[model samples]
Target: MTKTWLIYALGGGWGHITRALSLGRIAAKHSKVRILTNSPYAHYLNAEGCLVQWIPDSAGFSATCQQVRHIILNAECDRLIIDTFPRGLGGELADILPQLQHIPRILIHRDINPRYIAAKNLRSFVAENFDAVIVPGEGKDLPFCDLPNVHHTAPWLIRSDVDLPERTLTRSHILKVNETIKTILVCCAGQAEELPLFAEIALKLHQEFPKCAVRILAADCPPNCQDLWISHHPGIECLAVADVVVGGAGYNTVYECAALRVPLVAIALKRLYDRQDKRAQAYCYWVQDIQSAIDTVKMLVDRIEPQKKPLPSYINGAVQAVHHIMSYKF
Candidate 1:
């Protein structure tokens, strides 16, 4: 019988969805591949042909346990790929691992620290149940305690061809704010609460450099801030037009910047469950505070020229990951 591969994406973000889609694109060609996540993401993944499972919202451990049991017992999965289990603020799954010990499992992690103090306490209690932990980078900044279980894997897997407008179009209609002030681009996932501060920074930078124009890009911007906000698709289009890009140090954003060779100003925003500091500092020239709109705009004016080094990509990353998963014997 053909093996059934089920990927549970617990983390909430476009990055997790992107990973699931990329893996499904690669693995579906050879075996049965399924993706599970919450709605909207599930709908999108289902539309893409992967067998989709939507994890229902559960207020507490009892609700989560019911959902997990239902899926694991019902699905005829031979292998399970989980992206950041204990790290995604859903630690209840850790307690129920013994119940699903019959299946081989793999955990995908892209953070700089696997044992980040916040996620460490939870992961420490649950990691033994996993068969492998795949780390995409060289493990430069991650904590050293979990070295034995970590697999230094390839770069992240991304959609094979993101539809980008012709590169020449970017240079043709270039809009310059002023003769001296350079252009800068800013973008982030929807939860960015520091946008107001960033806008303030942008105003300051514009005052400092009379010729600069800073473009703020995001999915959902407060109505009052529409003047600078470039919504979704248009915002992504701006990436090709930008001289430098500033935003949070998210896995997808960082990878996209590297792939496009744009200089980055990665922000360090603190949340109850997430922080991008370690991921930002690992890359050269990636600064945290430069995400302030004014500071970012000034930084762009100072360094409009592209960095000398080429960027990274995951064109082969999917293939490599599949090979690893396939090589494992149950």
Candidate 2:
């Protein structure tokens, strides 16, 4: 019988579904892959051979939980791939864990604040349920609590050859802000409220570096954002033109920048469960404040003129993750 692998990617930001899709895209080639996500960005996200179930706003907490549980029961999936949060965003998976013990249960473990370890009793929850915990690259800062089944892989990046733009056209899209001819790309997910924060950062960067063409890449842009705010372009395409990328220290932004050899100035955002500060530090990023970000980006941009810093060895974490998941057996 063909096995169905259901991935639980219940998170608010684009980061969760993006990472989940990276694995699902590959896993779907081997078996049926179903992604359960709540991200607003998941509306029309297409992954071949994978079914994405987007949970909408329900009445309240109980309603959301009931909806999630109903989906799992109906899915009849042979495997469970939980992203980040071990027991779902609101512990919805806890009730179904015992019922699903007959099949494989895995986790794509990323960075988390240590406080959550105690607050959620994640150590015990994971030890009892998860057969394997796959830690992608940039996850060095995560506290694994000595779980015997923990494994490591490269970073889970979303860009594939199909997503890349034509090399000839890439250079044409970048407009020069001034004579310096450098590009500083500030990026974030398509969150309307997050737009102002990144927009302000882009404005400040333009003030500091007048020569660089500063641009903001958000999936959804307000018309008033002026020429600087670019919408509808894939974030990966913008990375091709950027000399430096400044953004919140999220999983996709950090590793994708690293994978493409783009200089990143990651500023930590206050996330309820995620600790961006630690993720940035794990990658040797030193931008703790906006001023520090400015300084670091300036240094990298300037250095690129004379010589570029040698990056660490490039490893395809997403490919490695696909291998582990597809090769695993009972």
Candidate 3:
């Protein structure tokens, strides 16, 4: 019999959507997959061959709850995979847990911060509800590390099909440019509010290092902040060729840089739940001020070597996660 999987990947930003896409693509090979999300990236999921149901951002609390309930009760998927938030984005899943208790459910609990640890009800809710919790990558100093049913795998990363030869070609092209011109890739997260800050940093870097060419990987740019912007470019390709990569301390970006062995300078952003500030400290260089970031980039641009180290063992989380999900008996 063909197994059916219903994946709930609700949250803001592209991280949730990308993770879902990575796992969903793999799961589709063995089982039918449908993604339930409210992210704008839902269209990308659809294009990538997963069945997607877009929950509008403007959806009210009752409507969101009803939609989730309807899908769980009617979709009849053999199992459920809930990503990130266990209580749903707006606590919509709380009302449907009783109906789903009999079904086999897997929760992808990425990481928990101090705020989450302080939420007594949230922790208790997850403990009582989920059959298994999969923590992608290395375990942090999180409160939920000791959960009996929790499983840890390699860092969950979106695998790229771009091969070594292609990456080499891209790198060669970048290096062929004038030796005096230094190329910097500014990779911001998919949040509009963060773009202006990055733009300012880019301008400062350009002003201080006049010989350096700073390019931003963004669809749109702020009015006052100006720099060469490439609206659409493959992230891995950009990372491979650039002299340095400056980005927010999101899990996906950090892991991508690590996997590619790029010289990374991370700027910790203020996220309500995800502890980017804490995560940034583990990387090569982390800065809060624009001036500090500029200085760090300048220091590392010439000294940093292209990552030649073998990919870390923890990066195989996608495959390991699929294996666990497929092997579990409902």
Candidate 4:
């Protein structure tokens, strides 16, 4: 009988869903893989050929828990992979924890902020419940670093050619573009709350360097900044060929830029869970002030070559994670 795996990617953002898809693709080769998520990115999950069960975000905690429990019990999965939140976002997994106690539970624990350091109860719950923990990519100085069951692997990236075929094609088209027209890619976070700041920077950069092309990848464009907006998902090709990339220090974007060896100017955004500020400081050319971030992008655009470099071993995190999962005794 084929092994069956149920991946619980409970969260709001694209990060959790993307990570789950990356691992799910690998696991599908050896097992029947299905994803349970509440993310709006469920369509992307379906597109990747995984069976996705969408949990309504507006559903009450108890209702959500019942839905998840029903699915898991019915599937009779051999293994369970929980992404990010150990207790499930909004504690929806609490009800199913006991039911899954007999099976192997793997937690894809990402880096956390200082606030989580005081979450003693949450940490203790994870320690007691999870069979193994996988930390993706340069997750040094994490709260769970000392945990005996925790395993560190390369940064979890969703870069499979099968997952992002459009990006692969875009990359080829971008590579053929003339080098004389300099390109700068600005990726505001998914929320795009900082659209005004990005607009101001884009205007300044356009004025300062008239020959350069400024492309902003955002959900919405601010007033009078329509020319800069490039509404597209997974703008990896634009990032790959850009003279410089200015963006928030979100995990997926930062690691993607790094893997493509694009020159980056990462502005630390305050997030509740992931310490993007710390990650930016450690990995990229980080700046606290918006003005400094713009200045850094300008400097890199002038100095650095717009050529791709081979990703380091640490950035190949998804592969490492798959190997570890497949080899685990449980």
Candidate 5:
């Protein structure tokens, strides 16, 4: 009989989906795998051979329990992996994990380190839920080694099968907006608080370089922020035409930018589990101050430059994660 698995990725579903797809791709070779997320990127996942389940953001426990019931009845997965729990405005969703304890379940944490020290209450709550925890990324910063069943694992790299399309940089795609002399791609996580700040920075950057444009490739951004030269999209196809890319210092962005060989201006956002600092440290060359409005914009526009290293050979998170999962014994 074929084994089955369910991967839940709700918070910042783009990253979560990317990470989970890596595992699913690998798992699909031997086991039936399904991916669950609340992002619009769900369509991209379905085509990859994994069944896609769309979970709404901050869905209550009852709703999720119904989802679990469907999975158990139809797929009968042997393993259930959750990417993160108690996400912002998604805290109420944590109730579903504890309910899954009777089954084989694992929590996959990609936050460089779990935010336990600073987020005591939140950490304690999560500690009680799952049967095991998997920490991805360099384990240098994690503090709790004595915790039972906690496993230290490296972050899975992605490898895509889809070849990127060849396209020329359209002159309209590289217009000068702010006084900055370059086309900058804002690669943020699409959080609401940072959207306005990014838009303001883009407006300011346009003022500095009226001939340039600031393009945002994120989800859920507000309109009419900077009437100047700002545009938004949900894919990275345009990055092919950009001169510089502005984004937070997440692992996905770092590797993606390096893989694309695009110049970067990165801001480090503080996350629930204090993982931002370490992520910033890993990509320090392009780090920006998330708190300062003017400085943030300037850091992206004035200093953004090409990476010193050779472009990465691959950016397929799905392929890398899957390869590692298949090698995992249990």
Candidate 6:
């Protein structure tokens, strides 16, 4: 009999859906997977053999609650895996998880705002309802690590090294100067409002490194950006060729950079749940402003070589996450 796994990935931005797809892709090999989300990029991220239940951002709390509650009662959902915000982005799932106690409920417990945890009293509620709580990133920073059945894993990224698209740079660009071509890839996949900020960095970097090719990789191409490569997810192929990667210090970007051993000059953005400041400090080259980002990029470029020395690869959380999720036999 084929099992069906339901994953709640309603968090804003591309991170949750991408991470959800990573797990769903693996789960789809044996079991059917349904990922419920509200990402604008859902159309581009729909995985084969897995269903994407797209919810709109305009859908208010009551409607979202109705939809999520109905899915929980869905007889086809053999297991439920929630990606952060256990109670939904705005408490939509507060009363939903408990209603489905018979089904095995798993939580992808990435770090969140400490104040929200206290306000929601999630510690007790999660401890009682969730059968398993997996932290996709480092669990050290999270306050509620003591929760029952909590497992620590690495960051879950959309694509792995082996899965990354082969070199996308042009032959002229690659063979330019008969040596390493200066390629700067700026990834801005989170909030669309921050596109200007990321674009500013891209422009400044272009101005600073006029001869080098500075490409902007975002959901939508920024205005006046000379070279723009648009994509719904992080630019994995571009990251492989980037001399210096620039982006916000979100979970996916930071770890993906580290995994590929590509140098990153990440600007830490303040988030309600994710502590990007801390992540920026720990994993990559941290910078405060556009100017600092440019300076760091320059420093990184100066030391960068055409051929990178092999370094140990970071653990891929999707593999480990699938292992844990699949272990709960139907």
Highest TM-score: which candidate?
A: 6
Task: For model 1, give the 10-residue run with minimal summed lDDT.
Answer: 307-316
**Backbone collisions counted per model:** 6, 2, 3, 3, 23, 0
What lDDT tens digits, residue by residue, belong to model 5 across residues 1-330?
A: 888888866654467776676667667778888877766555544335577777665566667656645554454677877775533224544555566555566666555344454554655655676566666654544543445756664455444324433333233443333232366566655455677776666556556656556555555444554334333322444454466766776666665555566655666677754365566566534445544533545555565643233233554544544454445545
Model 3: per-residue lDDT, tens digit, 1-330? 787889898776777877887788778887888888877545533335577778886786688778877887777778888988787776777768757877788888876566765774767787888888888874655666677887877776556433333544454454333434567778875676788887887777767767666777665665454536655333554665576888898887777777766777898887777888767888657887888888889898667544433333324478889998777765
Best by lDDT: 6
Write model 4 residue lDDT over 216-326, tens digit each, in one string. 766566646787776555555467557688887888888878877676788777777878887787778998776787778778777766444332233467778888877
Look at candidate 1 and tell me the lDDT of residue 291.
Answer: 41
RMSD of each: 4.9, 3.3, 3.4, 3.3, 5.7, 2.7
What's the true lDDT of residue 9 in model 3? 84
Give a tens-digit lDDT track for model 6, residues 113-177: 78888998988888888888888876566866876588887788666656654453321343122
Off by over 4 Å in 1: 1-3, 39-52, 55-65, 86-88, 112-127, 138-149, 160-165, 168-183, 190-214, 233-241, 272-274, 284-293, 305-316
Which residue pairs show backbone clashes in model 2? Answer: 154-317, 155-317
Candidate 1, residue 100: lDDT: 65
Question: lDDT order of candidates, best first?
Answer: 6, 2, 4, 3, 1, 5
Q: Which stretches of candidate 4 lie over 4 Å from their true place?
A: 44-46, 56-66, 160-177, 192-200, 219-226, 308-315
Selected candidate, larger TM-score, 4 vs 5: 4
Instruction: Please provide TM-scores, in order, for all candidate models, with all chains considered together.
Output: 0.73, 0.87, 0.85, 0.85, 0.66, 0.91
- For model 2, residues 1-330, the per-residue Cα lDDT tens digits are 887889988887788888888888777777888898877777646564578887874436787778888887677777888898888888888878777777788988888777887888888889888888899874455677368887798887765645566533554554334323678888876345777778777888878988777888776663445777775334665665577889888888877777777778887778988877777776636576778888888888877751133232455677788788777775
Give the C-alpha miss distance for residue 227 in model 2, angstroms. 1.1
Tens-digit lDDT track of model 1 for 1-330 = 887898877555555666666666678887888877753334433334467666754335576656755676567888888775543345546555556678887777655444354545645554667776676543545543374666665455444324455444543443323333356666654243555755654445445655546666655563355565655432334565566777776666666566566677777556444446665676424554544444545655575553222233325356678778888765
